[model samples]
Every structure is written in C-alpha cells, then in structure tokens.
Target: MRDWLIQLRKERKLTQQQIAEGAHIDRAYYAQIESGTRNPSMAVASQIASFLNINTFLFFPEHLSEPFTTALRNSPIIVAHCDLELRYTWMFNPHPDFNTDVIIGKRDDELDHNEGTIGLMKIKRKVIETKKPIRQYVSFPLSDGLITYDVFAQPIYNDGNQLIGVATVSTELLT
Candidate 1:
C-alpha cells in the first residue's frame, strides 16, 4: 500500500513535500504514510484524492476489478500490485528512488526495497488461494527517517474476473 502511494505520487512527478502542501499536511507526516507506518483519516485520503484529481474509491477499492493505474497518477498514498505468482508488478508513491529506473517490470518480492513486509505477503497468498478480496494493514520502515504507515489491501482481477493480483494503498496517521 505504501508502495502504491509512492508510485502514484511519482507518476505525477510530485514530491512528497509538494503533496503535503497540496493536502495541507506536513511533509514529514506524509512521509510516514509512504513508509507504511500510519493510518490516515478518511478526510486526509479525500484531501489527497481531490488534490490528485482521482476518485477516493480508487484508493480503497472494495471491489477492485479494473486497474486503477490511470487514476493513480495524482494519488497521495503509495500503492502496489502483485500478480498471482506472488510476484510484485507495481508500486506507486513519492519516494524519489522508486522511479521507473527501480521498478516497473521488476519482481517486487525479491526487491530490496520491499523492507521485509512478511504479513503482507501472507495475506496476499491467502487472497489468491481464496479468490476473494481482502483488506488488511501492513507497515514498513523507511530508512529516510519517517514513521511507518498502515497499508490497505484489496484484490484486482483480469477481464474475465479471474483473481490476478492484489492492490494496496497506504496512509499515514498524523502524530
């Protein structure tokens, strides 16, 4: 989730500081959201969505059937997606290093940037096995000096409605 938020923000070329200012939030606090340590208020999510020109529901897709990549360009939270093979395919957020040079076609699971999020992997496996949408919280530490964030997860499917992967969105709780 945190990863996805990072991906979304980067797609727009917006820095964390820029998103913070746009959402009327502190840059540090927004960093926490990207790091997978905090849970943001719904109001915060809405503020971010509005600022990014995306529907808030895309950030928390309860019935995720279509890919929300186009809508995520301006998303404030980091988002990520993994395929049925349990390989990570996407992550969106504001972290500078996460640009196309790092991700895109890479395997997210073996990537060092994953930051050791074991819980998220387990939940994703369960979702794939059950063929149902799931929501949960996952967190990861950012070495750049920011608290973790509470990530939100759901399932994404292909055109035939076959469970394909999982999508996540992360938000930071303002401390």
Candidate 2:
C-alpha cells in the first residue's frame, strides 16, 4: 500500500506535501500512510482519489483495466505492456519503434537483470504481488547511459484470476 502511494506520487511528479495539501490532509498523516505506518480512512481515501482525479480503487489495482486503460494511456506519461517474465512486451509512446534494436523480444532477459530494464522489472513484481499498479520506478542508468527507463505497470489477470501479465509504461527520464 505504501509502495503504491509512493509510486503514484512520483509518477505524477508530485511530493507528499503537495498531495497532502491538495487532498486536504495533514502532511504527517500522508507521510505515515506512505511509510506504512498508517492507512487512510474511506473518506480520506475518497478525498485523495478525487483530488488526484484517479479512481478510488486505484489504491488496489485489481480494480484497473479497459475502463482505465484509455485514461491511463492518455496520460502525459508513456504506457506499455509486458509478459510476466518482464520481457519487452510493447509500449505506447508511438515514438520508440519496437522493431528497432532499442528494444528486445520475448525471452530477452529478466528486466531486473537487464541493463536498461532493471528498475521496471523490480516494480513489476510489486504489481504482481499486490495485484495493483504502481506509478513511480526508481530510475537507474544503463551502461549505454541514454537508454535508461523509468517505468511502472498494472498487473493483468484472467477471468479466473490467474496472473496473466502486466500493462506498463515508462519514459527515458535521463534523456
């Protein structure tokens, strides 16, 4: 839960104080929530969700999908898709062509072990574990320097609730 909040704040390029102020909550309270020391009440959650213009259930992403995909894609940030192993699934930027060597194919490597894809890989597991989406990814540089990505994802499952894969997005934050 705390991880999700932190990710969401960072993805929005916002800070705890900012969200707390905007959501009309105490900064200390929000910090506790982000630090895993507290949980927001239903009313507080609703207020925060409304202020963020995000669906309230976003706190738990089993509640995310088709209805939110459009909203998520239209976000100023990039959006993407990936298999459970964290391979380079697909992206939505419309700029970085997948056919280019800039990306890879199935069975390329675990995202965490890959040079540019590590951070994304790390967070993907969190999404899978929590069955929720995260917003921010700890950005790290690859050996190539300019090829790094800051990514996050929403885990997708089947009607049977079987873990399918993830829908992701990222940006070359360093560039």
Candidate 3:
C-alpha cells in the first residue's frame, strides 16, 4: 500500500509534502500514514484520497463475489461482518485476544465486555437501521493497550438490494 501510494504520487509528479499540504495535514504525519506506520482518521484518509483522485475504499481493498470473510482475510485493513441481528458472523485481523470459536455467534457486549464495545454496537445498529454508510474515528481498550481505528461501516445488500447485514473495515491508528 505504501509502495502504491509512492508510485502514484510519483506518476502525478507530486511529493509527500505536496500531498500533505493539499490535504491540510502535517507532512510528517502524512508521511507516517503513507509508510503505514500510522493510520489516518477517516476525514484525513478521505482528504488524502480526494487529493489523489481515488476512492476511499481503495485503501482497504475488497474483491467482488467473494465471501466477506475471505475478502477481508487478505485485506490490508481490519474487517468484520455481522448478521442482521447484529451478531458477529466473520472477522479478519481481529484483536489478538479474540477467539473465533467464542466470538463467532456473539454480539460485542457479550464477548468484549467494554464500554467501547457498546458504542460500536450502537454504530452498527444505526447502520443496519438506516442502510447508510458511516465513517468514524474510534478507540477501544485491549488487554495490552488502547487501539484506535478509522472505522468505516455500511449496510450490506443482496442482488435485490435487500438488506442483508452490516460490514466494517477499519485501519488501526498509531496514536
């Protein structure tokens, strides 16, 4: 991903500083994001993507017609899918302490036991109810430390445009 961004910037005859300025972010911070050492907030990522003339989802990358779990397992970003009932169905690159066998059929509150999990559940519920997309900067506590993510959640739909569930892709942030 860093290499792709570097190459694209080069093709456009732009420098990291130029992009940072265009996005109105600190150059050093933007450099860290481009190098994958730090993840940007959704607003920052969107600004950068707009400056680069690319879709925001390009940062996460997903394949069509593949199972959500499979597509996310190979993704550069952390991803998860939930059923219509808001029970977790699949996860990729989940928190280190998470056990798939235990969490597969559970809600965040049932397994995570954290206040942040409650907030995340609310966000998921909103997406499911509204059938709209949302991007937020969120942080949660883990066993070892706190982690922040540029969280992107959206309602999933079938071929008939019927709501199926919700899916989320989040890139972890350094700070």
Candidate 4:
C-alpha cells in the first residue's frame, strides 16, 4: 500500500472522495492508487500530487534503476539529497571522514565550518533559489590533506513545479 499517501491524506483530514474531486479523478481510481493496486499515468499522478501538495515523483517507482545503483555502489562517487534548508536527507558513498549517521539531518555548515563547507552550502542554496542545475568543484580539508570533488547539483521540484530540495552527485578528484 502507499502508506505515505494514506498518512498524508489522514493528516490533512481528506477522504478519498475529496482527493479525487480535487484531482478531477474518480474516487475508485484514487482508492486503487492509494492501495497500490493501480499505477497512475504521469498526468494523473501530477494532478493528484498537486492536489495533495506533494511531489509527483513519489507515485513513480524507484528513481534510480537497479543497474545504475549497482554500478554506483562500486564507484568512488557520492550521491546525496538535501532538503531546501540544505540539511542532508539521504546519502550514499560518503567520504571516509563522514558516515550516514554523522551527516543525515545535518547541514554542511553544521558538520564543518570552513571555507570549503561554506562554499558547498552556497552552491546548494543557489540551486534551490534558482531552481537550476549546477556543476562546480568543491574542496574540503581532512586530516590527510585537502580533497577536491567535481560536484553537480540540481534542484528538485514537486508536482506543481515548486522547488523542494536539491540532489547532488560528486566524484572525488584524484591528484
């Protein structure tokens, strides 16, 4: 079942009929979607998501395919998602100095207060504000030395095309 959808609906005190009316869909169809029995098309998903004030991507399957995830696991690349506030939401293949436990729910500035961390935060903020993708280099100081990474950041949006967060992919540059 789409537990998240149910939870959101309950939280908003909205019934399936209410949601269906708002999205201009049939109540039964909405029920099927909530029960995970029927997948909605992109247009239908967008309408429902807009009415529900959530991201349309939530109705889709996994964002990354299995093959891509498998390759990413063995690659020396970092992938991360952050909320609009720049707090880390999810991450994979973090640098040696940091782990998921240390990063999740924390902003870059919270983890380290240096020029590099500050720069990274600025870049993320720009993406959120401009709703655009960016590619740049960022560096961080560690016990060993300074590490540079080629970073790409993109703004994530909800069904209404509202900026919600940022997603980043970074590769450590070997000197």
Candidate No. with top lDDT: 4
Model 4, 78-129: lDDT tens digits are 9888888897756777777886546655789888898889988999999987
Off by over 4 Å in 3: 1-76
Write out the backbone clash pairs for model 2: 80-168
TM-score of model 4 (CA atoms): 0.61
* lDDT value for model 3: 0.75
- The Cα error of candidate 1 at residue 145, in Å, is 3.4
Model 3 Cα lDDT, one tens digit per residue, 67-155: 76575564547777877777765566677777544555468887777767877888899998888998887778988788877889999
Better of 1 and 2 by lDDT: 1
Task: TM-score each candidate.
Answer: 0.48, 0.40, 0.56, 0.61
Candidate 4 segments exceeding 4 Å error: 1-65
Instruction: Evaluate model 2: give its TM-score.
Output: 0.40
Candidate with more favorable, higher lDDT: 2 or 3: 3
Q: Please rank every candidate by TM-score, starting with the best.
A: 4, 3, 1, 2
In model 2, where do residues sit more than 4 Å from their true spots?
1-76, 94-104, 107-115, 140-150, 171-175
Model 4 / residue 4 / CA error / Å? 19
